[model samples]
Target: MSEISQAGGTLGAGDRNRSLTYIFGLMLLVGFGSPAAGLVDVPITFFLKNKLHLPAHEVANFRLVAAIPLYVGFLFGFARDRWDILGRKDRGMMMVFASVCAAAYAGFAFVPVSYPMLMAAVALSAVAWSFARAAEQGLASMAGQQLAVTGWMSVIWSMAASVPYLGAYLIGGALSQALEGRTAEQAARTLFLVAAGVMGAMALYSAWKPKFLYSHLKAEAHADRPLQDLARLFRHWPVYPALAVWFLWSFAPGSGTALQFHMQNTLHASDTQWGAWNAIFAAAFIPTYLVYGALCRRFTARTLLFWGTAVGIPQMVPLYFIHSVDQAMWAAAVIGLTGGVASAAYIDLLMRSAPKALQGTIMMTAGSLYWVAIRFGDVLGTRLYEQAGGFGACVIAITVVYALIVPVLLTVPRSLIATREGEVLPLEEPALEVGAQETLHA
Candidate 1:
């Protein structure tokens, strides 16, 4: 077999690049299809503040409901790994999810942006996006190992996640303005219509399908023994600490929702300025991803994680002191710059630690921890901001908690640290056969 599947089936650098590019787009679209995040997030938040006059905690509550599906995304991941859609694996499921998401958003355009309606609509979108996102990650992990680009998967995936936010902040200011003149109902129709259009495009793309995705390699036999693979999730020791690290790093009280409200209400910033702050913050990461990717090629995961976390924790402290939008943007840049190493290293660890056969379950579970943390953080942070001495208190707590992440690193298994040095992770093949033969069809 070719090392990096090439034209003649011999894998080469170019083949890996091509595969990585494809996976990058796959990850980006799944993340971007998210209607209420990144650049679009500003509008969503502004809508709540303007239309409903929701306080920070109430907004956090909204986010909690929207994000709940993400917290349980492992169920969807498990389903993806366990069965093929209409007897198809990644390909069929991709189409199924894209179409549903497209319709869900389009239908949302017709609803009132009232609390109940918005909550229900966001819930549906979250569930559909979770399934699609999990399916794509499984595809990426399997294909990435095949192409030998696993080392840089985090950098590329983070790029997919943040690059859109960068553009979203830059252009999102304008996107928000485009809807500003309209009433809340009209604005919901226009904004959600745009989101619907994006998902529609995704559906069309999935319908055509990419042959290389299915052609990458044969899957392991874990499909039939789904329960066994899930059982192994606990069986692996490294997973525990890795999960703990993800949770601790993410669970900052009121970090997202409260901080956002702080920016809007206290900073007295315009929507464009807020978007600019986010845009600048995201811009800081692009170069950092390049640097992190280069570093990962040369250094060990422990080396990167240790240093990355060290720098990142202090930078977040600056947010507690910012008085103006400009100062906040500068602070955002610092935080973003320091974030690269830790972000890249964390994904590298997860990529190395996840069982190749159970990639979906493991990665999504790690991701679910992140979303779960966000849900909890949103509520906790908001509550703390309301009662625990305001924004300054939240920042101090966040800084201290992140410091705890470094020690958790001590608990990761020795085997994964070795894998991070470029050894292969043995695939956990299921004892039972996967799929009815028909489901295996390309």
Candidate 2:
């Protein structure tokens, strides 16, 4: 046997680059498939606000219901980690669930329009999507760790998520307007049909099986002991810090539904203008995300974490100053820029801390926490917007939550402090696994 490269040596640098590129493309597809993205979200929100004539609090409640499935996302991740999906592992999971999601969307499209039905349909779709997300993130994290490109992988993931906002917001906004003359049932059919089409494309791509993904699938270990893996994941100290970061960072009380209502009620912003704001904000993240990709190659996670959180602490401050829609639009770009580096760095930390065998469970749990935080934040934000000092109160609350993350940085293990180009320091804890790395290196 020959020596395996330190980063699993199965693939050379060029090959790793190619694989990362492929994964980026897959993430893009998955991002569009996500219900939170503009493709599904804009239409749903418009339908609720314009057609059903629901208030902000009611809209938030519906959102909470639709996202209920995502809050238990770890169970889906556990399923992915433990099962082989007819012996095809991640690939099979992606294909099957993407199809299921497409079918769910189609079901929603044809069904009679009712709030309960819409919420139930979206929640069911969320369940299928949770599985697909588990596979997608699990594969990306595992491959990035094996290839020692976690930072670039983080960049790829964030960019894949953010890039869609640019065009999708505009398109979704326009699409919402286009459906104005149609009845609720007709609009439901039109919007969800478009969503079904995106998921259908996702299923097809999974079937195509890109080379890097196929190779990674071939190299993965088949036998999965969930209890043992779960124990090990809990015992791992590095994971806690990453989870804390994700939860705190995502728990912004000033954003999402609260912010939307503020723009509508206070600033008198129209739906199309709101979409333009999102588009501008998302576009601003691209350059900063790219910058962080370069910065991650040089700095350790600790260094980046400190500075990133510092930048994040003041991110919500811009919202405090926005008194008009035009000011809000400019502030959106500022807010996006402030959090871009921090968001990418957080994902880098997450990918770095994940145990090799239990990547899916860990990633999904983190994702679950994100949904939990966002939902609860929405609840709090709505109350604050109504009873408290309005949007300014929410902004202050968000800034304070962001500030709490700086202390969490201290909890990260010393091993993960290394830069992406370097090796993780040896830990005194139990080994994650010997098989996957050993096989890839072999």
Best by TM-score: 2
In model 1, where is the ten-residue run with the lowest total lDDT? 430-439
Query: Candidate 1's residue-wise lDDT over 143-173, tens digit each?
Result: 5554445667788988887877777676667
Q: How large is the C-alpha RMSD of every model relative to the true structure? A: 3.2, 3.2
**Candidate 2 error regions (>4 Å):** 1-10, 212-224, 422-442
lDDT of 1: 0.72
lDDT of each: 0.72, 0.79
Clashing pairs in 1: 4-11, 5-11, 87-439, 253-381, 254-381
